[model samples]
Target chain A: MSSHAGSVQAGQIQRHKLVDRLYHWVMAVCILTLLATSLLPIIGWKFAWLAIHWVTGLVLTVAVLFHIVRALFFQKPMSMVVDGQDLQNLGSGGRPGKYNLAQKLYHLAIAVLILSGIASGLVMLRKIDTPWWRRDPYWFSDSSWGVIYSAHDFVAMSLVTMIIIHVYFALRPDEWHLTRSMFRGWITPKEYKDHFDPKRWNAEEEA
Target chain B: MIVKDIMAPFELYQPAQLKDAFSLLDSFGKDAWKMAGGYDSLDWFKDRIVRPQAVIDLTGIAEMKGIKETPDGVEIGALTTLSEIENNPIIKAKYRLLADAVSHVASPQIRNHGTIGGNASQNARCLYFRYGLPCYRAGGNTCFADTPEGINREHALFGADRCVAVTSSDGAPALTALDAKFVLQSSSGQRVIGAEEFFVGPNVDILHLTAAKPEEILTTIRLPSAWAGKNFYFEKVADRNVWDFPLVNVAAAISVQNGAIRESRIVVGGVSAVPHRLTQVEGIIQGKALEEGTATLAGQSSTRDARPLNYNGFKIPLMASLVTRAVRNATA
Candidate 1:
């Protein structure tokens, strides 16, 4: 039983507990669904996946908002944000994080896609006689809907490309378990250490 | 439960004293592995390449942590995080080049947690072996890297034989160029190994890279003060601008006397199993004027002895270009 359970240190901080894992997976499914639905219109599958897209988009929007609230107020946010140290690491040619280089880029790409999707959705809504928020006179007028629509289309294309890369990289056998980190919440201490601590790992043999 | 069914079931041993740590290590022998930040170790464990029965956690040991400045040089603790080293006022003021190298290690979260000892001792970033294939590094019969038709882009440019995995640490070349020394501690006593001899060739022992005994711990890294006045620069060419491993990197430290290269140490990273010191190139550039043609010739000379694998032929030119750039940057 001791061998099976693995030894746990007394004061070690649980980076990801059961609840965190559940929320992450739930968010992943919702975001992926939203990404697919949002992309269909630009790729000419809009009519075919419209109902599903609309449903998923609405649910994702609500879910993302909820997640943001939870992260900001209810739960501690994961420290994936780019910091001064990260910028330094980037310059050094070392990918130091649970997320790594690709993952950090993926996060930024996703953030841009989400923001663009929301803005575009609001603009397109005006066509259906529903206005979420009227564009301020200082920002843009009805005549600039073409510009907004085109910008949205560009962002949608970028989102598709990012998704393709994301899926392709994720499916590679070496990286498949990275997805499992979201599901399992707790990475094997080995994974945490290797993907994170080169110094510790290197010096350990001597210890 | 079956061994295959166990997720991350490994024992954790935290010895309070260095002697105690060595005793536990000696008892368990090869079955015991040390844990620091667990970065590279955890990944290997996940791949099932390193399944140690006992893990000796080094985090709890006080002797192996912190950074100290001595009149001779800087003595960096094994467990000192890259962030700590990068942001250390002494390191930044005295060893700007080293600080610059550590700064580029990874992301902020990783730098905050990863130690210098771990960075220097990290394993090869060979794509094939990392994916859990029975490559030569895993003591398999055949060498996957040298197959008749395969992707050998990331293979070694030097020390190529049955295996060609390149040394994948960024800090190594920088440290080597600065002439760093590593202090190792075991039950017997203390010993110092030059950073240059730390990495073992793939043909030697596929399992371990350094010559450190199992019971020993890398306790300190000493960088001499003589390396301070020289201008140092690290340049790497990679696939992307941000957060990507270098295809080839050059760490060059040079002392210029009136427009002439008085002395220089050129160390090339990401191209071989160890940070390759360019003695031939340094010899050529010694007392020579730093001109464009000379720089180009120096670059060519540096890469003259390169023994690249099938797919990594581009690295020869890429490394040369990086060397040229590093020379220009250091001289400037």
Candidate 2:
């Protein structure tokens, strides 16, 4: 049931822009494809997964770089910050602004994991033949390489866990509107009033 | 360039005598790995992390294989399995802290297969070091665990020079607390050193964890009667009860007279490259009554010099609490 009495109408508030939506979906697809290509081979599947894995890794890395630049230069960075008030609100179940504490934490965790994966993945690319360079395993000592591999492997597994939790939350019945906003780039005005604090998060400012 | 996870073929020598083992070591030089229990050696071989030309099996040396009661104390051979020391009646009676500490190592399976000497001489347990990462302990120029984002929750909080890997042996601190002496033998001669002095820190030598030379072998561990029958306390806090090394382990043998401590030997492991003896804490607690105030004070002052790494700052508090607990347990 809609709680708002007047002024704001339904389906008029923008939650995400078109470029942000495209970036989100593109990154999601790349992550899923990377996971499949990297993990399927580990589980005894027979296929040429290396080339696909590396190529998709490069794409994901580029997408992450693009997102970082876009968020820093074009977006209001403080909107996503989980400050002291956000943490206090998390305990009290107070109304969130643009993102809740849990959402911010998930985003931060995903960002860390992906950045670590990209760094280690880039180092690992030196070990395999690519269009740009020949395979050079001796760039680092065995032990140094071991650290890279361990970091890369750790990030991969952590992303799997984070994504599982993410997808599970996205598929919930009540949270479907938020998920739909990622695709349609907007939410109903009723959802804006229902889920967010207008004082903390101004829709006009976001627009 | 090297493909790991496959054991390369190497020559094996089972020397029945100490002299023969020394000869094999001399012949192989630095290319030989002294195999006592094959606990640490096997993993290195399996991973191709260490490829020795010859493996000098000290298991064949009969003289280095049992526990015997000496006139002043007890002498435990270097090749004695952890399980043997854990189950020995004499060790349990006289130096129960050693037995208790040995019991906390890895698991029953590892205890059965692992020897006390091997445990004492084991390498750094840092994942980077173990995986043959080019860390300072592995003859590299840098310590991988010293980085801002390094996975070093199990690293050292004290005496970390260029290497942050900790001393992982559970038996070392116990022996140090008991004021034991390590008997080392080589082709040239035999020498005895204090148990506390046996372990070398990263500052002294990052390449080797012990004072024993490449030619020498740890022949015996002498537990003197000084701290043997004292009020003993040993505790190991690990990630798991069954199969894990300690995050911080404490061993204390305190001599109390009229509820006041006459003397105490306290050693902490897993917080440094060697078993760190808290001489300052010992001094502070001497002649003081073993009470809550003294224990708490001892705990508070224990971490005065601890310099924890990026992910191991928790170890400072953990080590301090353990020392406090050990002092309190001694009162109990």
Candidate 3:
């Protein structure tokens, strides 16, 4: 990966690339939209929410697919994987490579929920009419449809809880730098030195 | 995603005589929807989930409209509203458990419109099935609530065939505890079944929740003298005080003789497709007094065979607690 000399200032570390940041924000918007449109109706607020909810679900599914491909092939996937060493660090308090144990676990958990949600949502799409095709409610039997709906609803509820915890941590004063890095695409040299071990995370190298 | 808010037009047949209703059902067969109070049937119609060719209105039948006092016990008309059953002076005095359980169903308005027959014959209340998903109960092969990641906080912990949906009626367990018998009539003849056998699980028949065939109509519910005026306890726990189905409801009747329990029948609802009769727990506390120690043991024994789903593990504990409370209240 070629580091853009013009974009990188002196004494700074690139935590996220421009494309990755765009993907993150786009995914965030889609998830928020999905949650709001799906949950608001259960609490007495009524509108044409089903259409918006399904559309946003499709958008999120596409974004997640892209992120999976990029993270697997173009990025350093090993850095995010939690191993026995990470568990040892819980007691030893050793600095994590790129992500702490909690961060890695949260990422893995969210990934499972999102993928399940997308898969279940795709099965449900057949039950509704779309611009491209007529509705086929019999694509799956009643029992199969029940399983699909249960998974989708369960994933949505879990995401609501996980997202709340994620936002709470992101807004914390101590984690402000990390949240800022998500938006600005870079972290100060001081933040890099203070948070990560240089040997584990070499900022000069490709992701 | 398709919001089916209105029902498709159908022929509505108001039959004043039972013979006319049976003939209509016989001709229409499965295409006929027998409606009592329309509390459960209306939802199915409004959602367009089950579109029938004919709707048979049973409200006009005069023979199935009153509670009659029999020499053995009492026979309640199947079409009696929940409010009518709960407010009946004879039922409140002799069979208070049934009265108490019926009163806890939905709200006053719903009880006013919901009939005992409809409540017993109501469909499973699983969100997936109610939302018109092709679930096991809906003639599909999969059981969503049994999955590792499925939302099953309000699902079954026992007697789950392919579907984990629980029995939604509060009156079912109460009637079961009271050893009630249901009188059903079809075109050919009339048949009687015990309350325990009135309900069918997914294992017995995946498509239907009750034993009543499409042509058969539940005419009367007979409460035998066996359980009348026995020490009774009834409790229902729900998400809302009114207008909500029970998360778990229990009904218990025990006869006490000289500070010792003579016999008891305990049934728990909303934990299985059928009202789960706690026979083992009943055996455990057969000759024992209704004390804390016996109640605790009975409670622990009630959930011994419970196989809870992922999100419904809490139901095991909740059911146990309710059983314990029911046992203690047998004497109170």
| Candidate 2: CAPRI quality band | incorrect
Q: lDDT score, residue A32, model 2?
A: 93
Which digits, one per residue and each the tens of the lDDT, describe model 2 over residues B1-332? 54666889999999999999999888889899999999889888987889999988899899999999989799999999999999999999889999999999999999998999999889888899888876667866566676656799999888776577889999999988888899999999999999767888866667778888888999999999776678889999998987899999999999999999999989999998889999999999999998989999999999997876668889888888999999998732
In model 1, which runs have C-alpha deviations exceeding 4 angstroms? A1-207, B1-6
TM-score of every candidate relative to the true structure: 0.59, 0.62, 0.62
lDDT of 2 at B181: 95
Q: What lDDT, from 0 to 1, does candidate 2 have?
A: 0.86
* Regions more than 4 Å wrong, model 3: A1-207
Candidate 2 residue-wise lDDT, A1-207, digit = tens: 243432233557878877888899889999998888777745534344667788999999899999999999999778787888898886788888988888988989998999999999998887654779745556787779889988988888888999999999999988887898887766788888899988888987878
Predictions in order: chain A TM-score: 0.66, 0.93, 0.94
Please provide, for model 3 over B58-136, each residue's C-alpha lDDT reduced to its tens digit, 9 standing for 90 to 100.
9999899878789989999999999999999999989999999999999899899889888888988998889887676
Per-residue lDDT over B1-332 for candidate 1, one digit per residue giving the tens place of the 0 to 100 score: 12332336788888877788889988998799988888888887766667899999887778888878899988988889999999999888877777888777767788898898898888888877777666656644345565546688877787554567877777888888888999988888989988766666654455456656677899888998878757778876667754666678788888887888888889887877778889888998889986777688888787787776668899988888888877777832
Cα deviation of A8, candidate 2, in Å: 99
**Best-performing candidate as measured by TM-score:** 3
Against the unseen true structure, what C-alpha lDDT does each candidate score?
Answer: 0.71, 0.86, 0.86
